[model samples]
Target chain A: MTLRKRIIACLDVTDGRVVKGTRFVDLVDAGDPVELAARYADEGADEITILDIGATRDARPALLDLIGRAATALDVPLSVGGGVRSIADAAAFLDAGADKVAVNSAALRDPTLVELLADRLGSQSVVVAIDAARSAPRVWRVRAVAATEETGREAVAWAREAVERGAGELLVTSIDRDGTRSGYDLELTAAIAASVRVPVVASGGAGSVDHVAEVLEAGAAAALLASTLHFDILRIGSLKRALADRGLSVRLPRPAPSAQQVAAWLG
Target chain B: MIAVVDFGSGNTRSVLRALAAVGAEACLVTSPAGIRAAERLVLPGVGAAPSAVEELMARGLWEPVRRWGADGRPLLGLCLGAQLLLDGSDEGDTPGLGLIAGRCRAFPSVADGGPRQVPHIGWNEVRTDSGAFDAYFVHGYWLDADPAAVTGWTDVDGFRFPSLVRSGSMTGTQFHPEKSGPTGRALLSAFAAGALDARVEAATWS
Candidate 1:
């Protein structure tokens, strides 16, 4: 049976804090990544991706620890990206128990890095990160890991090529719409999904349940969201029901309330 | 205590919050020692199966958790955590904990034709006896399980995939309970209530 799409929550952790913003500006602090991850987990996030954002080995170790702690405490898949440049970094994250290590700027500098990673970590362990945004002629270019470097690459082709070279999945984000809450760049997402053979996780913009509906309809295998979930504006149940109403096939968890959900349970 | 096994994946805090939200005395522990100390265990995991299993091995939680599940403690695996409950997984060639019998792997993300993507993400309906319930999914691979063993299923891309599997005391779901809204909370609450076997009212999709 074909697996239903997933709703992933992106936690941008900087110094152990969950930091998020649109276009990487007007950032706000939600809480500790661990705390925030837990909150989302309770809220029913399908998957949690922790992008360290900062590029450092120390941070890598800490992130791995976080991953280990998360793996033990969580019941969902945790994807760790950011600041990863070498096999060592990927290994570290995996050693801490990450499902996949996402590579962006590092792979762009050396397209072969994706292949190398696939060889070392296996393609399933390597996730190629594509931060896509429109450039001249409405062309899509990938923003590097930390938005530092620009690559002369096409996102749709990049997705196809990465999978061709053994990359397992594509985690593509729209830099323009990141944190915009306007919605996902379904146009770009759909375009890339068409070009890729592997699973493409549409990231960058997700403001509401409607945005999620738009992207899933646009053909994304999954949609990645940041910030939207933290505020409780867009919830998993509502989104799932919304998608179901639109005829998407998803699994609904039993809506059993915890004792604490009852005010009287506090006593 | 309903134990949340800590393997350092992501959102340990979040799962605990979920457990707390459900009014389960959720305790986060990394070692099998703590796991053995609990009445029930929630083996929540994310990231890679092999690595997660590796860490579980490292912490010496593998055997005990298996034994715990064997001894009638209700074990719930979520997402990758759920995937690891199987016999084998395609991600990283890792052998699952075998608490539940099945091979877990990623299928072709999209059907052979059209422009669909992989890692099927987002929310959809979970069909049940009462009616269809809305929930979320976020993974490339699903449980390739025997139809009888699959307690829950979802249709995607014209294919039916197992979404939840319950074998004895072991219950697992590919969806995340913490991220799911009211319905998800209800599901977890039911599990906590020890009523996972019963189907609830047909939820109106938002």
Candidate 2:
């Protein structure tokens, strides 16, 4: 069985605007989320993610309009999340042409909502988003939404339970490793890889292409990124070729990104 | 029309737009039948293990997605979507699709207190040991498994993680491209165009 690997493009949005940066401290305007997403699709992004970072401070109702434009603009899959409060909100994203809606704070508020959503949409539609922190050694806890200001919860344990309850996948982000460029927390990643039965994509702390290889080697089925690609320092075609050469079983191109396209991208 | 599962996770709109912008015929699908009939499948997600998987289940696409990945019928998982391909996650003690042989864990050195913030966000160089171009990253939990499974990698604070991976019929990433400028655009294009041939062809036929 030959599987084609996918490259996912994520856009962290705030107040209907696309933002780019390293630490989430100093961010620059990338462009309109919809326009940029469409451009990347034209360039060859396998999928797209629209993250509403602003959803934390204020519910971004404008996302509906943005979603409509973005959905109408691309032919690939698109998923949206951030401040998604209820099943109705999830439905709203789909109505706007989103393929999925990620509920974070809401899910934290009601863990059983995963089961509720699973019953309504199925097991694959409900995604539990945990933005957690390390309170102590080997102890990761849900950082917000009632589980707040405490460190008694074990993140790994919750992951297993979520699957049992009815979650199809997991997206784990290390608030510490995020935007650090120091490299991913491999030790933590390994631990998660060892425990979970589902595919795990490593996130946070990447500076070079080798990091991608490192996470994959660590057993992550996928690598989620942000900074490097924004810098125009790495190209996916080259990375694919490099992976293919390493005998890691990558999605090889009959004719990868033309030298021109790659060069243009680098520029 | 192809199905793009939506339940409240991932950068689904951008993925859809990328497809349409590139002139690929696609749709954001939510029903079991719609997903089952999709010529090709694109699974995108974000957030915690429990929640991400929870949403996938809520959408009633667990069976369909699992079947697609298992069948090797041109399936792609991006960012958290890619992570879901793993067996489990430490973020929320959640299990994933199990398409790949690995688990997701929390970041280390968080207790150490210097720069071990959760949700590793931002753009950094992605120089891979494979001698390929570098990429970017943004998240907290990382992947840990066998060294042989890596496709691409990047460095940050002296640590490294796989930016890309491929295990049989599945592939995934831990980055956001809809935000990455031109380099991201090129990569996304390659994914929709050059990087994948089987899926594109199958999608066309379907």
Candidate 3:
């Protein structure tokens, strides 16, 4: 049994509520983060990533209370990101019940923070989130601060550096494809997965289960879905079934009893 | 009570939460006294092996833990906790409790023709005596030991490694059952319910 391709549900949280946006702009409120996360876990999400989009802008910490609530409700691993500037900040999230702490802007500012986080809270618990946009035909550059700032560093190179610096996993989001519902930037995801030894989670532009299949086939170890799952355009169970039918390994939820089976049990 | 040894590593809170979700009476055991009084011992860890071992020693837990397993008590290890049960690990060149006869080695990069990632971080299926079930994994190194000692195995990138192992009263899992959804919750619930005796019997028969 090879490591199954993961389907992670991302909650773009602002304040205490889960929200969604198109290319990191024009936000729309979805629901409470805890409630949505619990639902996703029930629906068979392999993992949950709660990215506090408002943390850095407000200079506030990641929603510790919210993470705690979600952690209680979720049996799967929960990864929290945003506004994690120091080891203490990352520690705070882990203490609040996060299995992993993802750093983006902080890591770009000081690459050593990656080493620190890995040193302080095991490499398995440190995830480096890279937001990238297409810079050239086949090249992508890293974007920081909610995709508002360009770092000029190439996406693939940064991914390799992050792994070298001690990030156990890389959550690579394509700014150009984010929330576009077209599909993932397969080329971009493949490049980073190829360059690094850590598992790469391909984020952005998931319109259909087929799109997820495409990216996973292209070498992404996991797929992060936000808009589609939040808006009810796609159901996680159906998507997992589709992937399983396509011969992709997925952690399918226990099958619900059919009416006949239920009747027999009641009888 | 199920005492979860807290050696200042990562993910202890989540482990506690998972235990609670399964309705297991669990608590964080931070000292040697806590270990001595516990009905069951759960060694939970996540981080470098050296620091984990250092913290355990600093807290005066190293000897008690080894003794607890030696006396054939119900002791379970999770992730780094499981790695530390072996003789030693290449991770940080740290020594383990040597409860099991093995050493931890890093996962190979070249498994088949493709490049495999380290820290096998995700959910994967594990084959055990009970059945095949999915569990969450996050580790760079796996136990290199005799096949007879392994209770369960998982295949990744064309390489098969021991995901779960049992030696007398000591059982360890490389994957985090607390983070592995329903199947994981079931495993924990069983462990809390005196299933270790059944495991011992099964091992003896096999």
Candidate 4:
């Protein structure tokens, strides 16, 4: 069977609570991160990515607790990101049950951090999250600190470097399209996807099923959804079905097995 | 109790939680003594094969684990653990347990399907004779074993490889069942029930 394109549900958590806002401002409480993560898994999310947007030295304990609870509730892979700076910080998240840790600002500040993370935690456990804003019609520049600062690094060049430094996957988010409900910055996503040999997960600006389908068609291996999923704007089950209808290889949710069926499988 | 072997690496907690979710009485077995006390063993690992083997040896579990498999008790190897059940691996030029007759090979950078990623990461379908179930997988190398020993297969990039394999009472899966949702839970429950062991016994009798 062909590899199924993944659908990742992202939770932007702050102060131990799930929150979302337009363009990283005017935050509003969505619900408990733990409950929402479990619900998404039940809805057939291939993976769950939790970004501690409010990640601080003081908030480390709360974030780890939240991640541990979410990880226990999930059967699928759990990826944690945001404010992960040092090897110790990443190790703490992994110990807290995060299957993977995503690095952004710290990675850009010190590219060797990716190598260190890969050496310690395996490359598969290291994800390089790149937030890019359109600088020209065909050019995208990397932005850091939740898209608050420009890094002057070309997005595609950084993507290649990250992969060379041992990033197993790239989480590319489009700052220009973020919270716009327009669609993913296909040009930016496709560029990064084409440049990197690893899997590219397109994030930001997922308003409709077609938008997601468009990104996948653009060569992304996965699509990360936040507002679209958190606010009930779109449902994962039906979205997967729609993608399947479109002939994209997607993992459809399976029925919960009964005790008898489990026995028979073993037999 | 089923002992989930822990060698200071790997996602042992997730394995424990998955076993608990499936109602399996399981615990982390870090030493030979713990392995001796358990009725069955589950070797779950991630990361590089050499490091895992090193950690297993460092923890004094190498000989005991190999002896356990040689004795033909139920053994389930997950991901890197499954790779370790083979004779050797291309990763780090590492030597494996040799419980199965094969070697772990890395995926080609370019195949008939054109350029593909090294670490095949994501959810993919594991096709068994009975049916197919999508399981989460993350690995850079795959097991190349005798086809008769292969029970389940998965396609990645441009190649088809063993996702699940069996040899007598031992079983191994390239995919992570602990993270594969319902399908994984069912497999764990079956292991706990000793249903897989029964199959091997029946085959031998037949």
Candidate 5:
């Protein structure tokens, strides 16, 4: 009856298309957000995060059509973020079939927004996403506006504050390791996870299944992956199997066939 | 027809979709009349207990829902909906419908001084008398129910609490079966079918 560590597939979308970048810049197309999300769900992703990376900068709302499509195609919970500045915006995403609404810059601007969303939509549906970069050795500062502005607030401190303000979960992304594929900033993740009593989802560097396992072992309740999953560098099924083999509890659709086993079957 | 109660809390679309996936004709019902008219009832909620109670009262659904339970109609509550069936909750000093004999309490801090998070959000294994299966959970409070009413239990950070409870025609689950993949779908399908058949048998006998 123990809680299983989750593997969350993140889809950073712009203009309704999935995109990926290094350090949150140099955006490149990944694929259709809905298709990728459905595929990940089928492959046993515990949850899916569809972040509308362009919403705030473009002064527009999240792609409701795309979110609705993704929701219809998958059974697992869908958490949508980006451009959620007001209750109405969050409502729009939830109405569009998102199970949870993630707020980042807006939450940094006014922490009460977290409480407001939690008040109206239930705390379980409110996730506060904090993008942080190492400010000093072992010190991480919160970044905003797409990791362009350093808010001067320490990451762990902000995480504690956000949860107190009614954030049910914290999506902590390490800006330094993000897209670098160097693996998650375990120190930062563990620190934030320890500081707060809410579940923490570790985002930003995921290079391999070992990295996913490492983060979960370090204290992350869940791990979010982008580049490796988007580019087919690793399959969700295999990663889950690898984690299970490592004795970390992970939910896989079924036992994934090994390459050698597939070869034998084909022969 | 299965009616998923909506009182301005939680997502009913996913619950509806999950029920549909299980071949149940589920729809959202937001009024007292709607609750009374449905063949079966599902109270699905995920917000603060006080607010949820306020909305149900405001919509004049408070009495109807209680009556439905009193009449021995098939009723299933999920998450906050399950919590609402209790006498009250510590989350909001809110008085619930009192359909089930329990009060919701916050999860205690980790005993070992290790970091055990509140709002235990993730997939957790649920142990029912039948067997074990995984379900999605996202809550800070766990129900303190009468042991006689408990049907299932889940362990979190060494804390054992009621994850499922049943009384008469009422059943409640602390986890979101709609979000638990195939296992969830099967549970929902079985619940709907069993409830419907029970209703049919009651009708025939009466």
Candidate 6:
């Protein structure tokens, strides 16, 4: 009866296809972005995050089309990120059926964008994505521009500022562990979660059910999965059941009615 | 036609989309005249209570919407729209439409010695008398009212609140039926099919 912790499927779409890579390179085709999104939604993903890794200016139309198609198929919340630099950019995604827009590099460049987006679209629709990497001993720093540049800002501090600027949720991605299958950065996620009042979605390094459960124990309101799900290493229903068996609340799909029952009901 | 009130809120598109998916013929109505013209009305809103109320007032939809519900016409409120049907809200100390005798209150930031985030996002179950169904939710404020007013209840970190309510011809759901997949679709389809209307009529005559 409690609020279920979210299991979000991340679709790192590049050049109109879903791709997964280790630490944001050596990209390999996962599936068609829209098809994978629809499949994950059917598999009971609580939410879906579509990050257009190839979101150049010219790629906007294709990304929008993909998002529109995916949104049409999804019944759960869908969040889109990558190249969202302005209010108009966020609006475009919403118009294309995205429930929330995740902004990382743009919000770091100008935090006011978060405020603007919150003002126009409500704070609940704004998701500030923080890509963090280990910079020094026991320190994680925020990275921008698809995790290619360092902002010199501490991850926890940036998270607080993002919330203050009106980000309803934080999508904290561990660049060091993304696709590494080691596990989420527990220390980094817990730090950010403790520093902010908004919900934090822990992303990257989800290789097993325990990894996912561990991050949630560290205080992430949601766990974002990509490669494990895209490559069919894990199923959403079984993962949810495992999480539930550990006493964590999750939305389990209802059993479908039998064909005979369906016939009787239709009659 | 069913008029989906559009006050420039973010959820209008989703509401319209869901209604269309349910095969409900709906249109975005902003003016009071449009509100009056519709056979049925849907008030779908997001954001703060004050601003949402202001948007309704700005479009002259505030009074007409109140009257539409008062006339026992079929009306559906979604999320913030549902909150606005109450007398007032703790969010911004805002006044509501006074159609329902209740208030909107914020969810506790801390419950059971653990931090509970505001703006409870994602999917949760809405338990009715018949059964429980998973539905999507995203809000910090919840309706504080008599249990008799509630048709469905949901729990968030030990804080139980009304998730679905019905008063006369008007129905309100705290969860987003438009985004809640099949369960939500069934609710919307039931609403479109005059399921609530039939019950309201039965009560009125009885």
Tell me model 5's lDDT, rounded to 2 decimals.
0.84
- Given candidate 5, what's the lDDT at residue A214? 94
What DockQ, on C-alphas, does every prediction get?
0.19, 0.06, 0.33, 0.57, 0.25, 0.32
- Enumerate residue pairs that collide in model 5: none
| Local accuracy of candidate 1 as per-residue lDDT tens digits, A191-252 | 88887667788987788778898898888877888788877778876787788788875544
The global C-alpha lDDT for each of the candidates, from Candidate 1 onward, is 0.73, 0.63, 0.86, 0.89, 0.84, 0.86
Regions of model 5 farther than 4 Å from truth: A56-62, A254-267, B90-93, B109-115, B195-206
Question: Which tens-of-lDDT digit does each residue in A132-188 have in candidate 4?
Answer: 988889899998998898899999999999999999899999887776778998988
Comparing 2 with 3 on lDDT, the higher-scoring candidate is 3
Considering TM-score, which of the candidate structures 4 and 5 is the better prediction for this target?
4
Report, in order, each candidate's fnat. 0.27, 0.06, 0.51, 0.57, 0.41, 0.39
Q: How does residue A23 of candidate 5 score in lDDT?
A: 94
Q: What is the TM-score of each candidate against the true structure?
A: 0.64, 0.54, 0.90, 0.95, 0.88, 0.90
Worst 10 residues of 3 chain A by lDDT: A258-267
Best-fitting candidate, scored by lDDT? 4
Highest DockQ scorer:
4
Off by over 4 Å in 3: A56-62, A255-267, B109-115, B198-206
Q: Which stretches of model 1 miss by more than 4 angstroms?
A: A119-122, A230-237, A250-267, B1-206
Pairs that collide, model 6: none
Which DockQ-derived CAPRI band holds candidate 3?
A: acceptable
Model 3: per-residue Cα lDDT over A1-267, one tens digit each? 688889999999987888899999999999989999999998999999999989854535438888888999998999999888999889888878888899999899999999998887779889999999998899998989999998889999899999999999999999999999999999999998888877899999999989999999999989999999999989999999999999998989864333333222112
Encode model 2's per-residue lDDT on B1-206: one tens digit a residue. Answer: 54667766646766666556555677888878888788767787655668877777887888788878888766667778877777888877887788877887776673544233234543445444434442334466777644565666655544676666665535576765544444544565555543542333455775
Per-residue alpha-carbon lDDT of candidate 2 for residues A143-255, written as tens digits (9 for 90 to 100): 54422344345678777776667665566666677767677767666777677654455667766667777877786655666655555555656766776576654533332
lDDT of 5 by residue, A17-48 (tens): 89999999998999999899989988989999
Query: What CAPRI class is candidate 2?
Result: incorrect
Candidate 2's DockQ: 0.06
Who wins the TM-score comparison?
4
